[model samples]
Target: MARRRASNEELAGLVQGEQTDAVRRLEDRVAARVLGDLESRFAVLSQRSITAWVAAFGSVQAESGDTAALRRILSTIRGAVRRLLGPLGPRAQRELDQALTDAVLLGARQHAAFVEEATGRATRPVSGRPSRGLRRRAAAIGAAIADRRDRALAILRPSRARRWSDVQAGIGAAQSALPATRAHIATTVNEAVNEASLTAIDHQGAQKLWIAERDACVNCAAYSGMVVAADADFPAGLSWDPNQRGRGKALAAPPKHPHCRCRVTAWEEGWAPEGVPSFPDSLRREARRSIARGWSLPTESGAARIRAARELLRTGAGLPKSVEEFAALAVRAGRFTDRTVPTGP
Candidate 1:
């Protein structure tokens, strides 16, 4: 007896899983480089300056005046921001260009292999080069990093700080930019991978289905299992009511928002072999589970969580105990009467 060939769903799942891992590994590499750079530069700037300041002024209140020492400290902060974030953009761009190109190429090959297995016909090879659009988007991500750096500088400006405590707090806020940059790069990678994957699907002349992760946000969950022409957009919008908001505008891709890790897979009714289950249906089921759970919503605002819990409860879905208690508190606080739903971006 011959060994059985893997079904299209299985292959597509493996390809998606592998692609996710590749993106994550790339994120780790880029993040590690960034963190290393930040640590080395920040230590030189912060440790020396902080040590000098505390040695000169024994108390935080002693540095409350706009004196020469304070001026020097602010100057140090400006220098620190520049040194820390100046090279981050180009560095990230280099990593994205090389790693994303390879990852997209591998994903394209996997998608092509799926088509070949299903139809027994060799597909045209996909170009491994990152598209001009992807390059432009990656550059935009770099620019975003620069923008964050500027914002951090603004936060640490003299007008914003008086005492050592204020400067320390501002520096704390500025350091948040590092993690934000890492998150932005990771989101960009997902967007790039999906764009390349969809292009590959188009090249293979196949339809595509949106596959939301099992714990995706409500916005992304709404699009799970959506099948569309390779050239067409998925029917639902990224956020808000799918029936009322952005329909037919969102292109078939994984990320409906920042940090979205959705993926796409090829789909054809006839290509699914006998005894193979429905991939789209399985995805939809997972999506429903995500919506019902509602505890894993991405929003951090109490109002947003309460609103989500209310909606889930209205639909007769069970909520986690914490969510129920939160909603109950909002109801008691009379916040629930305010009918405005928080449509997150």
Candidate 2:
């Protein structure tokens, strides 16, 4: 028997799993590079300091170490760290850029293939070139890495120390800082990769997209089954950023926060599984409720207005009628106005 093809949902899950692995591998690579550099620099600095101390005191023991020589050694180590920052920042950025480019292209191709399989429509491959958004995100991550490195150096710098134990304690502190930095790199880079992929699919002509939550927590669970137009902004009320509430521009797309595991996928009409909320059905219900209630659309908040427009569109009547038109009509009539809505092909 011929093997049955995987369903679209299954394909989406597979894509999410693969991308997660890719992100983890990229994180490991970056962490290794950073820790390796730190170790090598510290080794060099330690060797030079030991030699200088012996020459100054005519002995290699910590008891023979002169205070002035110790200060000079600390200065030298700090200088080396500063010099390392120049090269390290660019190297980390280059890694992030390449990783994000690979991830976006992979996601775009996978989504396009799935769409073609389900809809019998062809999709062009996304270019591997880095996007402006990707570049900006990479630069931000690079700056963060530099800042963390500087902080780590500060924590690791030994105070007026005459013994090896004091220096070792500082080194221990530096090592302790790496775990948090590694976590930060992973989450930030993963978010950038996901955003890039979503942008790629949007540019490829997806008309609608749905959120695919993975092991969702309470916050993301509320977004489950939500669908929106390809180009429409997510409802402001659903924004993860508190400052973005009521602001239409806060989150234009999915994976709204750092380390958000939710994947946004192309949505096909009539393809949602049972129990999944259909956008049209939900919109119609909202419209009916709004009409039944004496709610002022014009005075309603932005979130309310968006909800009203979506409802109007679902009733097969709101076409050519923008959100503003719907709000104005609601204000004039104090009720929902029924009109013929244009259906998409």
Candidate 3:
């Protein structure tokens, strides 16, 4: 017998799995690079700090310590640390930006190929300029690193004793901050991959998308069967879109939190089944009620409006009015807030 072609649902599931794996691998690679850079820099800085401290205060007893000499030593250590870390900000931003861009573009191409194979339609390649979200995410990573560096500086401040013990304690404290810093960078990579995947799906002309929650946690379970239009805002605003609040204020798009395993799948109009039994019934009822209460529809525009309304009914949000509006809302809701980004050191 001839080999059977996979159904649309099967293809979507396969793509989702593959995309998740790809993103995870990319994240791992990036995280390793970041951690390595941080470790190397920290080790060198710590050694230099120790050498400077030993030369300045190794023999001086606490009681006989010259205050001015201690100040000069601390200042030298601070300057050395600052100089060593200065290049990290730009390096990290560049690494993250390049990695995210490459991952997203690769994801877009993968989505386009799968779409073409499943539909037997020749689809256009995603040809737009780089996503602005990439830039914003890069800047966020830079800011996070700066904040961590500041904290490390605070920890390194010389105590009144100016003893060798004090210098060693400060170095130890700064080193202890590394694990949290690594986790933060890892989370940034996770979010970038998600944003890129979603962008790729949209560029492939998908009409609908659905969240495939990891289903391992309460938050993920609540969002498990949620679906949205290709252009609908994710993590739908709580004040303006109360319906999506069921997923929780903390839940907005995939990678809802660090180490999130959720994925999104896309569908074209005819490829997907009409009935989505998995969707929550309460939301459907609310959508219908909302449409009923809206302004009157024009007779000529009735069919189009009805289609839009039906889409909203299914997804729990109106179809995005325009691309610009969708982009704005997606960025506002999908990207991480300052509080979510980790501050370590």
TM-scores, in order shown? 0.75, 0.54, 0.56
> Per-residue lDDT of 36-137 in model 3, one digit per residue for the tens?
666777687667766666676665334317677677766765675566556656666777777766666655665565556555566544633346865686
Error at 297, model 2, angstroms: 41
- As for candidate 1, its clashing pairs are none
lDDT of 1 by residue, 224-296 (tens): 7778888887765543233334644666577766777788767787765567566666566545444433434
Ranking by lDDT: 1, 2, 3
**Each candidate: RMSD:** 6.9, 14.2, 14.3
Error of 1 at 89 (Å): 2.3
Per-residue lDDT of model 2, residues 188-294, tens digit only? 55555556556655775554454433333223333445667777755645422133345333355555554555556566575443575454344333333332232
Q: Is candidate 1 or candidate 2 better by TM-score?
A: 1
Q: How accurate is candidate 2 locally (lDDT)?
A: 0.52
Candidate 1 segments whose C-alpha is farther than 4 A from its true place: 1-16, 39-49, 61-63, 113-125, 236-249, 274-277, 294-345
Identify the candidate with maximal lDDT: 1
